[model samples]
Target chain A: MMNEQRREFIKKTALGVFVGLGAASGLVPAFSLEKTALPVWDEKPVPGKIRWGMLIDTRKCKEGCQQCVAACHHEHNVPAFKNRREEIRWIWKNSYKNVFPTADNAGASKEIQSRTFLSLCNHCADSPCTQICPTGATFKRWDGIVEIDYHRCIGCRFCMPACPYGSLSFNWQDPRTAIVDPVTAYPTREQGVVEKCNFCSDRLIKGLQPACVEVCPEQALVFGDLNDPASDIRVLLESNVTMQRKPELGTKPSVFYII
Target chain B: MKSRKLLWLVTFAAISLFAAFYLFSNGEAETPQKPLARVSVVDSTKCIAPKEFMRANHMQVLHGWERSVVRDGDRVHIASNGSRFQKSLGTCLGCHNNRLFCFSCHSYANVKPKCWNCHLSPMETQ
Candidate 1:
C-alpha cells in the first residue's frame, strides 16, 4: 500500500516537471534574444507608398554600347558559360526589332532603327512567375519589385514557363568554378535553381542606385517611385509615349521604353 | 502440478521485468556525442540566440524566415525584447560561415540541408 502511494506521487511530480520545463522553454524569452539589429536605413521607403519603376529612353541609348550590361552582370557576379543554355544573364543588349518584334514602324533613321536595345527582367506588377511558383520562391515585394528567395526555390521550372519574358535562368552547372574571379559578396548559385535580376534589392536597402542605372553613360535609365506623380519616371512617362514589352498581356511591366 | 505451473509463471514474469529494467536504465549511463566546435566568429563572445536554442531550432528559424520575408513581406523581425533584425543570410554569415561547424555537425547527424543549392559559404568566395 505504501509503495502504491509513492508510485502515484512520483508520476504526478514527473508530469508537472515535464509541463513546467516545456512552458519555460517555449513562453519565456531565450537568452541573447535581445539586441537584434539590421542595417539602419538612411531613407526607408514607406511600405505601400513607393512603387519603384524604371524608364528607358531608347533614343539616348548608344548603339553597341554594353557598359550598362557589363556593369550589371559584373556587379551581380553573373556566371558566364560558353553554353548559351547555361548562361546566367542579368541584362543584355539586343537589336530593337528583336526586342520589340510586334511593333510596327515605317521609314525611320537607320541609326534609330538599328539601335541596340537593352533587355532585362521587367519586374511585372502582376508577375506570372510569382503567381506560378509552387514554393513561393518568386514573389512580388510591396514596392513593385519581383523578388526571389534562392533557398526556397526547388528548381521546379514552373516559373520558367510562367514568365512571359525569358528572364529566369537555371544554373545547369556549379557556378562557383565558372567565373575567373568570383565576387564573394554575392551568393553563388547551385545547379538546378533559377535566378533573375531583382532590380538590386541589396543596393536599394543601402539607398544606392542599381548597377545598370548608375553605369549608363547616356543617363537613359530613370528609376523612381511610380506612385508619386512628382517623381522623375512619372514625369517622363507623362511627357513621352512609353511602350512596355507585351502590354497586351496586361502584366504591367514596370520598365518602360520610349522610342 | 498446480504449484509447478505457478513456479514457471513466476520465473517468466521475473525475467521479463529484469529485461525491461535493464533496457530502460541503460540510456542513463550512455554519454551523448560532443556537438561540433564553434567555427570562426567575428565575436565569439556573442551569439544570435541561446546556444541550445540555436542548436535545436536553427533550421526552423531559416524556414520561417523564408515565409516571413518572401510570402508575407515581413522583412524586419522584432524580437521579444523589441529589437529589430532583418531576415537575411548576412546575419548568419557574419558569425558562423558554416564552413566548419554546420557541415561537421550536420554530416555527423547524417542530415543534409539544401541551403548550398543557392548559397555559398563565405570561405568559398575567398
Candidate 2:
C-alpha cells in the first residue's frame, strides 16, 4: 500500500513539472498570442509633396558617352567585369528599342530616330519587388525610394528575378574586393546581398542631387518630386513627350523618359 | 508512513526548483538585433566645376580633341610633327580621357555606340 502511494505521488509530481516547463518555454504562448505591434507613421502626405523621379531625354543621350554609367559605377563601388555576363550596372545607357521595344516600333516619324535611352531603377510607386520579399528586407520609403536592408536579407535573390527592368543585382562574390574604400554615403554590402539604384536616397536626405543627374552634360536626366506640381520634373513632363518603361506591368514607375 | 510523506515532499520541492532554474535560464537568451540599411550619395561640391557648369559642359570637356591628346600623351607626342608641345593640362587629362580606350574596346566587340546616343558632338568647332 505504501509503495502504491509513493508511485502515485511521483507520477503527479513528474506530470506537473512537465506542464510547467512547456508553459515557460513559450509553447503555450505560441498558440495563444495576439499580433505584434508595428511602428506607425502619422504624418499626412502633402498634396505637393515630393515624389522624386528621373526623366531621361533619350534624344540628347550620346550613344557612347558612358559618363553617367562610369560615374554611377565608380561612386557606388560596382564590380568590374571581364565579360558581359559579369557586368553589373546601377545606371546604363540602353538603345531606344532595348528599353522600349514597342514604342520603337510604334511607327513614329523619322524625327524620333535620334532617340536612345538610359535605364535604371524606376523607383515604382507600387513596387513588386517589395511585395515578393519574404522578409521585409526590401521596402519603399515614404519619399518614393525603394531601399534594401542588407543585413535582414537572406540572399534568396528573389528580388533580382522579380524585377522587370533587371535593375536588381545579387552580390555573387564579396563586394569588398571591388573598391579599396567604398562610398561613405552608403555602407558596403557583403556577398549574397542584393543591391540596386536607390535613387541616391542618402544624397536626397542630405539635400543633394544624384551623381548621374549632376554629371549629365546634356541635362538629359531631370529629377524632382512628382507630387509637387510646381517641381522641375513635373514642369518638364508637361512640356515634353514623356513615357515610362513597362507601364503595362502596373508598377507605376516614377522614372520617366522625354524623347 | 511519516517517512513516505517526507520523501514525497522532498521530491516535489526538488522538481519545482529544477523547473524554475530551467525557465530562468531559457529566458536569458539574447534576442538578435536587426541591422540598419545604408544608402550612398555623391558630394557635388567635390567636383572642379560648379554644378550648373559641370551639368552643361561635361561632354564637351570629356570628348574634345584636347581630351584625346591629353589621354594618350605618349601616342600624341610620338605622332606629333614637333618635339615641343604646349602646356601641361593637369591630372584631369588622364582620368577624363577614358573614352579613347573604352571606345576602342567597345568598337572591337561591335557593341552599339554608347557616346553619341546620349550626348552631342563634344567639339565646339562642330
Best by lDDT: 1
lDDT for model 2, on a 0 to 1 scale?
Answer: 0.59
| Candidate 2 chain B, run of 10 with poorest lDDT | B117-126
What digit string (tens of lDDT, one per residue) describes model 2 on residues A161-231?
A: 78888888877776656654444323455677787887876455344689899889988788887766677
Clashing pairs in 1: none
How accurate locally is residue B67 in candidate 1, as Cα lDDT from 0 to 100? Answer: 71
Task: Score candidate 1 by DockQ.
Answer: 0.07
Interface RMSD of each: 21.4, 32.2
Query: Which regions of candidate 1 are displaced past 4 Å?
Result: A1-48, B1-46, B97-99
lDDT of 1 by residue, A1-259 (tens): 6434644554677744432332223333222211223533422334445568899998898877889878877767788887887888878887777777666656446776778788889998777898778878887776778888876788898988888778889888777667655554456677778889989876665457888899898999998878777788899999998899878877889999997
Assess every candidate by TM-score: 0.71, 0.53
- Point out where model 2 deviates above 4 Å: A1-49, A109-115, B1-126
